[model samples]
Target: MRYAKFSMDDPFISMAEVRALVEGEVHFLAGVALLPDGREKIASRSSTVKVSGKLLSASHDPKEVNEAIRGRCFSIYPDVILGRDKNMFRALYSEATKGVETSKRCPKLDLVFTDGVIVAGIREEERDSKSLREHSMKPFSQSGTMDPFTSRLMVNLARVRKRVLDPFVGVGSILLESAWMGLDCVGVDVDPSMVTKAKANLSHFNYQCHVIQGSVTSLNLVGGFHVVTDPPYGRSSSAKGATLRELYAAFLSVSAELMERGGRLVFASDSREDWRDEIRSAGLKTVSTHLIYLHKSLSRAIYVVERG
Candidate 1:
């Protein structure tokens, strides 16, 4: 079995489970998760996952861990724990490997204690901090641009089959994540300036994506592409003279048209209303909804829908 440990105390932590499910079949217990083995790639690229590894053992007794890890060449690495005693787990690890032989250079083992479960596993993948830092520091940025981790989460939620489309792409925040996953990317914006900025940002990261200056309502493209976008919230972003309701309805209609049957679309909105009417009208099925509190006055609802 494989397991993932999520960052604690994040308002977006709730989305971690959904993201895990979207990427692979996994079960969440508190902030720690157990996923089927052979999902190293999925765990590596996930925004919410901190560390993932092959489980060696999960038991209260350190002898079980010691027995499972005997004769294995590994170094003990303690990961940050949530809702558990860190030093206790460290001592447990020390006890488990006291007499066992290990190699300090490669194949490290991570000790994770959370929700009263003790897990010892062989470390396989970790978050790419350097890449994430570079993506977050893109040359062109705006006030309402989605944060890098959240942007990546949106893309991951879509589970892009082949291509990704961002109808309200602003500065290519979501597109960059899609590009990082080596997926074909197409971005459209009503504002020509935003279109240019999006292209520039994508190019800055050495990502080649198709950027078009057009409204989602009038845009046309081949079907079967997954969609991920964060539409205008009308505070720092302009609505282009369309009400939130109208803009969202149009967005849904266009998305439904472009997506093939069973294609996924993950979109975000700041409005409190869930847009059930628009979703039903567009013949889309609601898969799930995740609420992320950005600040005191700004909470965004991320909706995952499938074209039917």
Candidate 2:
């Protein structure tokens, strides 16, 4: 549905994540757009504009914009007008309510202008970053723990309502986020210390998840899980004697076997090596790829793959 203007944690990652989660038509507008089957997903949770109309000219005066907004809000009978900031849209809101009586509480007409385009709609939802932050601050966190925002994004991108698996769960970040989204989660790690810490971390959040200490390649897990993981990487990674590519190839090969038909896998890596051959050999199809630049020397490649 239509979304309001809000700062994304990372626009590129958010866009890619939304595309992966949404199953139908998607259209990008000025400050909002239409997304199919994403009403309940996290990708839609940050949106403020619930219902919207066609784009309007950014140069339109307050009166003209208000008239257009009034036409869109006719069915809802919004009593309050809200803008993204106290700038042009605020003037528009004031002008719109000049001859109108304000209600104590009613539907709100929301406006957002971006890149010479104006989007008008009705307000619906707001994101709670505070609660998300609280959940992210587990008692036992480590350097490798995934950030809550990205963890939640990855879980949503998986688009699995039933179950999710993180084969390289570090401190239970992915598992915790999946459980927070009301999905049954399982996490496997080769390090017993990590597994124990992950379990404790989940407990601190009062979340229930299966945390096991086992190698991802040898784990006897039941098929049918949407997997999302950030495997061990870098010079300090616990890859034993194998190269990064070799470890990734082995994990993907076994992951393909552990996934149900049509299951999706979301992976992240910092390696600059090309993995097209490894991905194909693992019997998975690449759905999308995104690159996130963390710093001058560090960039991550995110891949969304589907089991064949």
lDDT of each: 0.79, 0.66
Error of 2 at 115 (Å): 4.2
In candidate 2, how many Å is residue 245 off? 2.0
What tens-digit string does per-residue lDDT give for candidate 2 at 166-235? 9999788888878777788999998898999999988987889999988876879888888899897685
Please list the residue runs of candidate 2 whose C-alpha ends up more than 4 Å from where it truly belongs after superposition. 4-9, 36-38, 41-106
Which residue window of length 10 is worst by lDDT in model 2? Answer: 73-82
Give TM per candidate.
0.90, 0.80
